[model samples]
Target: MRRAAPLALLAALGAAPLAAQDSAPCGGDFGTFLQGVEAEAVASGIDPATASAFVAGLGPDPEVIAADRRQGVFQLDFLTFSRRLISQDRIDRGRAMADRHATTFDRIEAEYGVPRGVLLAFWAFETDYGAVQGDFGTLDALATLAHDCRRPELFRPQLVAAAELFAMGEIDHATTGAWAGEIGQVQMLPADILENGRDGDGDGRIDLKGSAPDALMSGGAMLQALGWRADEPWLVEVTVPDGLDWASTGLNHPRPVANWAAAGVAARDGALPGGGPGTGLEARLLLPQGRNGPAFLAYPNFDVYFEWNQSFVYVTTAAYFATRLMGAPIYLAGDPDPGLSGEQMIALQEKLVARGHDVGGVDGILGERTREAVQVEQQRLGLPADAWPTPALLGAL
Candidate 1:
C-alpha cells in the first residue's frame, strides 16, 4: 500500500497545495492568523463569506492543546492496549452490526474491495460505532490547532478544507467532533471527507454522523483510495519456531510466504494463504511485543492500516480485531518479556538518537521506526534482535 503523507494526501484529493510554511509564524495574534487562513481558503475556492464566518470568532482551544499533549495512553504495550480495546462486547456488537448491514457491506466489498470487518473495526474503535463522537467544536478545534504552532503545517490545510466543506454546506459552525477536528462517526478529517466521503444511502449529501451506511461506505472508499488490494488478507496469527532469525522480521523485511513456511512459521489455524496462482505474495513476521508474545504475519493489506492511523499498537489491534470479527479464533498470548517503562524508553530513545537513529520524535512509543532501530542495535550487540527493548539493552547502550 502507498503511504500518503500530508502533501500526498492533498495531491491525491486535488486540493490546493499549501506552500511551504516552515518559517511561517504561529501562535501570533489570532485575528492575523485568521486573516491568512481566510485568504488561503478563498484561494482554495471557498467563498470569502464562508471562510470569514468559519474563522470570524474562532479562538485557541486550551482543551485541544491539552489533548494533543496528553496522549500518554498510546505508550501502553500492545497486549495491554489491545486487551483494553478488544472486549467481547465490542466483538459481539461488531458482528451484530455486520449482520445488520450485510447488504451494504456486500456492496462495499463489490465496489471498493474493502471488507465489512475493516470498516467495522475502525467504527468500533473511533467512536463506539458512532455512539460517542466527541463534542469539541470542529471549526474551533481546527482553527486552534492551525494557529498553535506545534503542527501548523498539518492542521492549517485541514482548517482550510473545513472552510471549503462549510462552503459546500457539508458542515457548519454547529458541527462538533474529535478534539483533533475529525468529523462524524468515523472521525474523518475534513480533507478526507471532501476527498473520499460517499453517500451510501443515496441521500445526495454525505451524512457520516447520522448515516451508518454513509460512514461505512465512505470509510471503505477511503481505504480503497489508500491502496487496499482486493481479496487480500491483512493479518493472520502465526507461531514462529525457536532460533529463527528475528532480525529478518518486521515490516521492513517482507519475505515470500513460502520462505516463511519453510522456516517453520505455521499458521495458528487453517491453511496459510499462498497468494494463489502466479502472485508472489510477501508477508512480514510481526512480533509486536517480542519473540515470546503473540505473533502475526502482516500482509500488504496490513500496510493500509498504518495509513489510517500511525500508532503501531492501535493499527495492529484494529487489524487483529477485524480478523476476529471475521470468525478467526482468539490469539495465543505467550509470556513475552516485560517491556521498558516510559522513562526508560525515553532514555533509550535518547541513546539511539545520539547514535544517529531517528525514532520519529522520541515520545517513548515503540513505533515502527523505533522497532527497526532496536532490531539493528540488537543485531549489533548480538542480542536476540526481536526489537523488544529491555533494561539490559538500555544499560548496555
Candidate 2:
C-alpha cells in the first residue's frame, strides 16, 4: 500500500487569488502567519534580516488547497496507477537517460552500490528526467502547507528546514520546487536534500535541479540510510501455491528463501529476479491485490522504496520499471480478483474505522493499513485471511 504523505502535504498550494480579507496576527491572515514564522525564525537564530526579508508579503495560496482536495491518485488501483505512470514513453525516455548518463551512472553505482536502471526509473518518475519539475518556490510552498489547516503538523518541520536552507545560503530564496517543497528533479524535501544531497557533478556544489548525477547519487545515499542492500533484490515477482497461509503475506512477515521454497513458492519466470538464488536472501510476500493478483516477495532493500514514497503502486512501479529498463520482462499477468469500486471501498473503510481497526483514513483508498484491518476483520469472521476487501465484507459488517 502506498502512503500519499508527500503528495498529501503539497496538494493544495497554487497560484490562486490572494484573499482580500485581512485579520490580526494568529487569527486568519496569511501576512500574520508569515510574521509569526519570521519571529520564530529569528528566535531560532536565523538572521533577523533574512527572516524579515523572506516572509514579507507571502500570500495564502488557495489554489494549492483546491489541488489537495482533488487528489485522485490514492483512489487508483495498481493496474490503473501503473498504466498511467509507467508508460512506454516514460520507459523510452528513461532508457535514453540511462544511455546518455552512462559514465556518471557507472561511477555512482560503483561508489554507492545502486544500479543505473533504478536511478533512471526514479528520475523518469520524479520529474520526467528533469523535464517538468514544478514551479512553486520552496519557502512559499512549505509555508503555505504549514499554514493550511488540514495538515499543519506535517508541513511545519519542512517549512523550518526550508528556512534553514535559505539562511545557510544553500538553497536560494527563489528556489522553485514541487508544491510539497520538494526540490530538483528528484522531488526531495529541504531536509532530505540538506542531509543527503551530494555533489554528483563534482562541480564543488550540489545542484539537484541541474545535475542529474547529484540527484541520483544523493538518492542512493538516502537509500543507504534506509538500509537498502546492494546484495539483495528490492522485490521479485513470485508465485504462491494454493492452500498457503494467506495471513503470512505482506511486508511485515518476512521469511528465508528456503522457508518460502519449502512452502511451494517460486519465481514467476525461470530464474531468480535479480541476484543468484544461492545467496540465502529473506523475503516477505507482497500480495498488492490480496491473493489474486501480481505477488512478489520483498527483500531488505524494499524498505528503501517506502522511504521514497509511501505509495505501494508508486514505489513498486519505480522498482518494477527499473528492471524493465535493464531488459527484464514486465509482469504481464492480471489479478485473479479485481479491486473494489470507490463507493464500496469507502463503505468498507467506514465499517473498519467504526470497529477501531485504524484503517488510516475513511477516504476510500485501500492501502496497507486498510488491507491489514480487512485481514483482521476476516480472521475475526472465520474467513480466509487473504486481506482483500469484497462485497461479502460489506454484508458481514
Candidate 3:
C-alpha cells in the first residue's frame, strides 16, 4: 500500500512543498511560533479560538527534544532488537492477552479480515497491552513538536488536526500520550486518528487510550482501509536451503509460494502460514541480516507494518512477535552480526552515495533506498545481493 511517513502528515503544512525538516530552528520565542501556527490554522479553516488556546497553553517539553535526539535506530542489529523486544515473558503474556480478547479479535477479523495476531502484537509492543500508553499530555507534546522547526512540516498538520479534534470534542488539552503527541494504546498519531479512529465500544466516543475495543476496532479499520488482505500472512519465518540464491531475496523479488518451494524455501513447520495445499500465495524473501542471519518470506501485508512505523527493527519485531504468539520458534540463524555504530552507518551511506546510488541523503539510516543500493552494489561485485548491510560491505565500499 502507498504510505506516508509514520506519525506525521508532512504535505498539509504549507502548500509550498517545504524541504525536509531536520533542523531545530524554533528559537525560544514561543509567541512567534504560536503566531505562525495560528496563521496556518486560520488558513486551514481550523477554529481560530481552539488553535489559539492550544498554542497559547502549550509548554516547551525539553524532555521530548532530548528523547528524540537520543533515538538511534541505525545502530541496532536485528537480533538485539528482537531479543530486547520479544522476551519469553512478553510472549506468554501476549498469548494470555490474546486468549482474553479472543471474542473481540474474532469479531474484528469477521468484519475487517485483518488478523488478530497482527493487532495483538502491536498492542503488546506499542503500549504493553495498554498498560503504558504514555504519560505526556497530547496537546503539550504536539505543541512541542510543531513549534520546533526540526519537524514542523510534519507536526504542523498534526497540530491543525488536534485543533479540529478539540473543537469537535474528540480530545482535550489534558489528553496524555507519547512525547510526539501520539495517543491511544497503539500510540496513533493525530492525523490517522482523525482519519480512521472509530468508536469500537459503541460508546459514541472514540477513546483509544481507555478502551481496548475502540483501539483494536479502529486499528483493524485502518488496516482494512489500507487494503489489508484476509487470506495473506504478513510474514513467516522460514528455513532457506543451503547456498540458496542469496541475491534472489528482497521485497523487490516477489515470487509465487510454489516457485519459492521449488526453489527451496520451506516454512518453519513444513507448512506455510498462509498457504494451504497448493495455496499458490505470493511472497518475497527478506534477508534483514545478509546471508548469515535468519530469513523470512514477506508478503504484501508486510509493507503495511511500515505504515505503522518505518523502523525496520520495529516493524519486523512486531511481525515476529505476532508469529510467536502462534507458537513459532526463535530464529533459525540463532544470531545476528554485531551491527554498526551510527557514525559507521553514516560512513557506509556516504560510500554508497559516492558510488552513484541514492541511499536517501546519507542520513546514517539504512532505509529502503540504502538497502536497495546495497543490493545493486552486491550484484555489481557478484556477491549475493542480500540487500542487507554488513561490516564487510562497509570496508569494501
Best-performing candidate as measured by TM-score: 1
In TM-score terms, candidate 3 sits at: 0.87
**Model 3: which ten-residue window has the lowest total lDDT?**
8-17
What TM-score, computed on C-alpha atoms, does each candidate reach?
Answer: 0.92, 0.88, 0.87
Question: Per-residue lDDT for 1-397 in model 1, tens only?
Answer: 1111121111212322222234333669888888998899889887788778878867778877665655555677888877877889889999999999998899999999998889888888888888877888889989988898768878888888988888888888889888888877887899889999999899888998899999989899999998999999999999999989999999899999988988989899976787345669999999999999999999999999988888787789889999999999889999998899888888899999999999997777788989999999999999999999988899889
**Model 3 agreement with the true structure over 1-397: per-residue lDDT tens digits:** 1122212111111112212335464646877877887787777787778777756777778776654554454346666666766677878887887788788788889999888788888888767788876677788777787777666777877887887788678888788877678888877778889888988888798999899989998889888887788867888888788778877788778888777888888887768764555766788888778767888999889988877777676677778878888777777764555556667888888888888888766656667778888899988877667887778777777
lDDT of 2 by residue, 1-397 (tens): 1123333122221112222222212326777777888888788789999878767735556555554455445566666666666667778888888888888888877777888777787777777787767777667667777787766776776777777787878776678867667888777887787788899888999888898888888888876766677745776788888789988887767788778877888887765443345666878888777787777878878778877777656677777877778776777555557568877888888889889988777767777788888888988898777787778877898
Q: Which stretches of candidate 3 lie over 4 Å from their true place?
A: 1-23, 26-29, 273-280, 334-339, 361-363
Best prediction by lDDT? 1
Q: Give the TM-score of candidate 2.
A: 0.88
lDDT of 2 at 236: 76
Q: Between candidates 2 and 3, name the one with more favorable lDDT.
A: 3
- Angstrom error of the Cα, residue 23, model 2: value is 18
Name model 2 segments beyond 4 Å from true: 1-29, 270-280
Q: Ten residues in a row with the worst lDDT in model 1?
A: 1-10
Give each prediction's root-mean-square deviation over alpha carbons. Answer: 6.4, 4.7, 5.8
The whole-model lDDT of each prediction reads 0.83, 0.72, 0.74
